[model samples]
Target: MSLLLLVDDPARPDVVGLRSLSDDGTLLDSSEVPTDALPAVARERADRPRWVWDDTARRYPPLLAAGVRVERCHDLRLCHAILRRSVYTQSSALAQAPPGPWDGPRDPAPVEGSLFDDVGPAAVADPLEELQLQLAAVAGSDEPGRLRLLLAAESTGALIAAEMHHGGMPWSVETHDALLTDLLGPRRKGGRPAKLEALADEVRTALGQPALNLDSQPDLLRGLRSAGCDVESTRTWEIKALEHPVRDPLLAYKKLSRLLSANGWAWMEAWVHDGRFRPEYVPGGVVTGRWATSGGGALQLPASIRGAVRADPGWKLVVADAAQLEPRVLAAMSGDGAMAAAGRQADLYQGVVDAGIVETRSEAKYAMLGAIYGATTGPSAVLMPRLTTAYPRAVALVEAAARAGERGDVVSTWLGRTSPRPDAAWQAELAAASAEGAGADDVRAARRRGRDWGRFTRNFVVQGTAAEWALCWMAALRRRLLAVDGRPHLVFFLHDEVMVHSPAAVAESVAVAVHESAVEAGRLLFGETPVDFALDVVVADSYDQAK
Candidate 1:
């Protein structure tokens, strides 16, 4: 007897609609509610209804602001993306239907200082019809249970992304400013940092080009070559290998420059406000199911400024991340007993050594990573045989996926997310290379492209599945945290790590919730199969301290 409540706005700051449905997509009731009364109406039915909305970020924010929170939702946009690409639902009517307005690119979710603000909401016109279409598609899938779980987890991720943005990550402006001043010297009104300018001076002098602009790559490269440096590129790795006076200071200058440009004073001013950092997150933006941030560097928070992620007074930050996520996912998906056993310990690499797979932990790690990622050179290739012999099932799984990729076939994640088919240009290359009079160069080019695709597929299966596991982990954690006695809210989520902003009194409970949710995630994904997904949880005053 689940209730499906379809929500849509008829006009901005005015009329909104709420249509209720029974379990089988049958319309049970319909009502028009004013925007101002939405919170009260939503709160009354929040406990029993599954809120169906076009977009969570757009619809849920105002409800959250008005002190109303719904327990579950079916975000049509997020779930539509899942079903569209899912292999299990490829033959469904929803998959074969003509593209509609829903196929348009999503406007990036709003952040505090975003230029692209969300327009006032208007009626979607057919929220009930869209939900029914989605239901039919889910029913048509071969693995309905699996696809349902995937959709649920994905929608939960959407909700969490919005909620985390609304709550914001606790930040300390004073600490952030102090650290910036100490490293780069005082903030400049219309110029570069003091320390950065000095390093730039050394880089130019060493290259023997007094007026060289370090910011311009071509100018800097030409200067280096003219001064007897055999560098082909100005990239950091290439620069590091060169034996020249400009190497050290140039590297220092680049590091400091990135820090100054990326997260310096201006960044703080734009992103951090009211003692919190609010960034707009785009869930499932990456083809591999990873999240992409629209602004504020949420995914790439530099380690130098982690101390600014301080908890509020009388509160603590519980930070935790999965240990060796991809490899563990590989073992579970492949059902490799040896590989799974090797992950029994906290450090999977060390466990491989203990299982006699390699002589050193480093070798074990290199070999396993090489196996899944299709590496064929360096230490990876040197140690590949030992890894393959030790864990044939795991190696064979990726090998099969690679072979499928070489044949231009599709591959699916552990759930149902499918790898996109080769594009028109790529297929043309393959066809032209197979034609009767094709030249050696054409054949070689096609082979190279095929191998590249193979490598992509080999890694895609593992990485994408790991992302699904992460969503599940976060979903379970969210539920447990909400159910706990004291209020503890999720503040930040990277792919594998999460930070909870909770009162110090509930910090221990939050840690327990973290461990329990991880266990629940493993159960939900792999069932009783005994592959461990270990997490390192710490309670501290700041993110850096927790680490």
Candidate 2:
């Protein structure tokens, strides 16, 4: 049995229209509950009925606040986004339905306030109708099972996102401040850190410019050139090549500047509270289904600052990262037995070297990246023929996707998340270049655009599917952790890595769950493929120790 939670306008937070739904979408029973009592109702049905709703982020937070947790949910907004663009359902009648308010992206999450504030609900205007349409689309798809799995994984991600927010990532401001102080000196008023200022002074002295502003790119470039160093930009890579007095100092300055700007004292005040780091996660935010963070730099946790990510007292942080996720996904997706065999080892790149695919580990990495990313020049291109000969299926799969992209055709991942079609402006430019009597410049421009899109789609198929694999991995881990005895829950997730905060006693159990989740994610997405998604799981007292 499942419950269809027809949420009312959030402004009237007290009201909710609930419908009991059978597995076949049949209405079994219906009732109403004040938003406050809804948690009691949810607790009554905990982990039993799948809660159907407009959006999980909007609805689940309130329930979680009242100490209620749902077992499962079907998020209509997320499903709509998938079904609308899926190639598997493009020809379905559900896709042909006239567009309505449900077609637009949901309004942003509400701000913190009283439930009785009456700010109006952000609920979808027609969730029941949207649910029916999504069901029809899935039922009519050629690969219904794949789409179903994708939706299930996506919805579970929504639940995880909300729960992770409610239970924020454990952070130690003292640890972070100490690390910052050790490396950057004590905080100063309205200016750069002491070490950064020292480095800037060194940069100026090295360039023989007493008053040049190191903060300005143009000023730095002019200063470097005036100092007799030939340089186009002040980028680290560009400056690293020049053998001059300013090289080392300038590079050091840039590194320190990044830390100051990204995770400085101001960042600490804004993102951290009550010894926790709360970042707003936007699930399905990226076109390829990867989560995008709205704040707190959750996706860009610098290694230098990771010491701040300490576990609670009597707890441990079990960190796990997939060794070579994307390449293994490519192997599984393309059914490349050779590549899969290479992935069967702990280090896929080393495994490739062992199999004689390439002479060196570096060569193996570059060649495979070249194949998936459509690199047609330089060392990657030099190594292409070898990869094509060695892993023909994998190379061919990406090449076919690239060719389709060049022709402005859409491509999809294994579970059917399709690449968006080229926009109208691009199509017009392509058409004008191909029209009768086009100029060489026009043709060249069109060709460049085509190749660019080709590269995008070339990587899109693998990256998008890799993101799907990650979602499945996290979703499965969430369920497994829930079934555990103690306080073990996922605290942070970054692409192929996840951190679970657990009691010290259950840290080993959490590590086992992490490994099993990786295996389960692979099976869910690729069935019984030979490709192995190996994870490096580390249980430690602090995040930095996980390395």
Candidate 3:
């Protein structure tokens, strides 16, 4: 049934079942003999387990001699499988076991009403208290104006609630009043402005009016403008909803509404640290040096979330975005004079057409993009031959890099970020296939793969460079904000969007700083590239209505 080998060294002959070798190099069950007889037996066997006499054990004239060692083949796969099975069995048993006292605390009783069911009265009241505490702390700080601005930001939250209520959505009256007070209150060293009562009166003026909320009606916009607020559009972009068939669009809408509600809760929680909502700023989060969201989903905020950003008593947010950033980046990298010149004028794609690179602006745009990205198929494929003929140097560089990568070499970004190389297994597979009568077609496919890899490597250089530009922009903006003596602090940042809280007096200055920072960022990144990174700005009383 089983086999066991035995061996003993002649130097110590007092061990049991000691033998040098076994017949056929396989040791089966053998006779148990006296300790002194072990060495003699082991010397006759072909393969045996080794044994040494244990002098430390005094009793071992020995019933069974010790110091025997078993040796077997070492295979990780077999070992892993054995361990995995044991773990699975244990986990399954644990899962079936009765719940312990420490499993979790009991859930609270569910509330009445659909909107208020999950959220309790305490939940509705806590945010207002939190805002009060935040304002109190900020007011007591050296920068009193900073606290006022934070309070102003809190008002935007009120606007969101008001908008919801105006749409006939359910909300508690206490919560609504709390939000309104936070919004209309004076945000300065002094208490609420004498005109604040008037402002509050104006806000309440729309309370019973149908379609006066920020979303359904543009009344809030008019009100803010009437109140001397300056508002403009920042950036306009379309969001294409994902296509998924649903039984009821209304149900889907409700689900989305609930999701936004949950997102709001999370956003407020993460943002309200230190009595103010200050989210983290991740510089160079994207490959293009644009900012990334670390928390509160600032960049990925839904349309509803935008309604909550508002200008402080005297401050406005100056928002801007680069127009056609990627194409400009491509032009700069390729050093195509015509493309660069066209970008400098108005449209880089049109510039290509003017240079006779293509018949139309659209074709030039696609073909040039395809070339940079190493797209040699589809519509891009049709233009490849023409692109190569027109811009051989530019095309060759990316193509050659792609070829190198397909050949199993690592590629690096402009800033020295290297792509990982193929592992030994991959190399071995390729080598084996090449040896097995792999024809020209096989070789050509390999080269094509390499070329694509090179294209990725080449683009990484450009994209990474762009990312650096964005970091410089943010850092410059932060520095400018800090340089100003007033207390309007930078609070939130999405890729290209920055929110600042400031007193009404210095809001325009803060806007100026934001604008100057953009210019400085451009200079820092491209030096004197003869191109501008223009930003569109918007200032509003509420985040959603800013545009």
Residue 388 of model 1: what lDDT?
86
Tell me the tens digit of each residue's lDDT in model 2 across 1-547.
5656575766776789887876667677877888678888778864488788988878899998999877778998788778888899998766675555555555574223211112323434767666777888998898999999999888999899988988999999999999898888889998887998999999999988999998888888899999999888877899899999888988988987889889988899999999999898878877777788767789898899999999999999999999988899999999999999999999999998999878999998899888888888988899999888989999999999999998999999989988887889889989999999999999999999999999989988999999899999999999899888786999999889999999999899999999999999999998998999999999998989997
Which runs of model 2 end up more than 4 angstroms from their true locations?
9-13, 109-124
Residue 136 C-alpha lDDT in model 3 = 38
lDDT of 2: 0.86
Which runs of model 1 end up more than 4 angstroms from their true locations?
7-13, 109-125
The numbered model that scores best in TM-score is: 1
Candidates 1 and 2, the one with greater TM-score? 1
Scored against the true structure, residue 157 in model 2 reaches a CA lDDT of 93
TM-score of each: 0.95, 0.94, 0.46
- lDDT of each structure? 0.85, 0.86, 0.44
Best first by TM-score, ranked: 1, 2, 3
Candidate 2 worst ten-residue window by lDDT: 110-119
| Tens digits of lDDT, candidate 3, 1-547 | 1223233335555544422222222333444456655434444546533222111012121222332211211111111111111212223322233432212211222112111111212211121222222323333443344223222222222222122112211112333223433433322333333234343334435333333343222564454344443543111111012121211322333334344344434335445432333333333233222344344455565554454455544455555455555556555555655455656645666766787778987788788778667776887779778777766655665666566666777543322223445557656655755786888776666555556556666565455445444444555655576567675555555444555555666667877887787677566545666555555555555555555
**Stronger candidate by lDDT (1 vs 3):** 1
